[model samples]
Target: MAEENRYTFTVRQATEADWPGVIDALTSAFEHDPVMNNVMGGDGKSQKVRDLFGFQIRHTYGPKGTIDVAVTEEGKILGAALWISPEGQKGGLIDEIRALPEYAKVLGAGLLRAAIVDLKLLAARPKFPHWLLYTIGVHEDARGHSIGSHLLDFRRFQLGELPAYLEASTYRSAKLYAQHGFVELFRFKSGKPVLGMLHPAPVTQVSKNNPAGR
Candidate 1:
């Protein structure tokens, strides 16, 4: 286990090289979400979903939309967070992901569901530029040690001045987001809540205090 004062790791932009590990992490993380099972199918659907997501993210958007990976001293992927800048293009990944043969049918259905929910939510809320928090998953064994919080912190650090957004698939995660200063923007299909947060740009004073620039 990584110690408190010595949680040594590096955060880097994820690459195609990280796809296999990200797939495995996403599978493990979402396996426990009953709604993911209901909508996308269960663990049985994990591989297809993971493959489609990885392909779309790595191939379509490339690094302009960031995927950050946290790796341990031993070079194991501890956790990851995917973010899309509010100023970046939207829905390209959705089209690419929905076009995958293995996932096409369910993907279409899921989007249709999202469309209805998105419309309803939009009707009640003011539109804001958002940094879409597509996914965040940590290895199961790493839970309860602030790994999740650390991952979010790392992503916020990377974002600098960007605002963050996410749709939480579980109530527990909504609470977690609340704890981290995210505001509930709206509730969507299946009771999932969309959250909005912002990360302030790093202060020059703070960076000046560090021996090395972070």
Candidate 2:
């Protein structure tokens, strides 16, 4: 746990019971995200936006991955990070589609089109075995307190010898990931310039430093 002013921040694996808070936090965090605005197609505060993110959170929670949340000592959720291991990546598309039926009913053909565009953008990226940092969101009210940094550091510690990957939706976020040792691999020319980043394992860095170990 860490402290900043009146808040004591702690990171933990989110449980099913945390779903409501998680959805709300993420929705608030991504409310102004360019890519999300493009896909959601509105002021980004509509019921469709909330339902879309709710569906995503529900589907992405499982044994093969984890959704970690940053909370205050008072139990207020301030942020969330979703990570999918290499094995979890295999059927992620199918799982996401299966989770989208209800949302699709509400969002209609626009949702399907958006999903395809998102998949195509993802497919254009390099494929390799790495932990996927699917999403990281900090509540708007909690932005300047470094809650996002704490969440990223928690995952970095857990990752250890494994590489981690993510597609950042904003340049500001891409810069934050860069500060945590991720290097930009590519950038997509969509509604927003989505930047892909890869964080190589700490072990890889150590091995490079000690040639004998290699």
Best candidate (score: TM-score): 2
Distance (Å) between predicted and true CA of 32, model 1? Answer: 2.7
Off by more than 4 A, model 2: 97-100, 205-214
In candidate 2, residue 60 scores what lDDT?
61
TM-score of each: 0.70, 0.89
Worst 10 residues of 2 by lDDT: 55-64
Model 1 poorest 10 in a row by lDDT: 193-202
How many Å off is the CA of 135 in candidate 1?
A: 1.1
In order, candidate lDDTs are 0.61, 0.80
Residue pairs whose backbone atoms clash in candidate 2:
none
Off by over 4 Å in 1: 1-8, 42-44, 60-63, 91-126, 158-160, 193-214
Best-fitting candidate, measured by lDDT? 2
In model 1, the number of clashes is: 0
Error (Å) of candidate 1 at residue 211 is 26
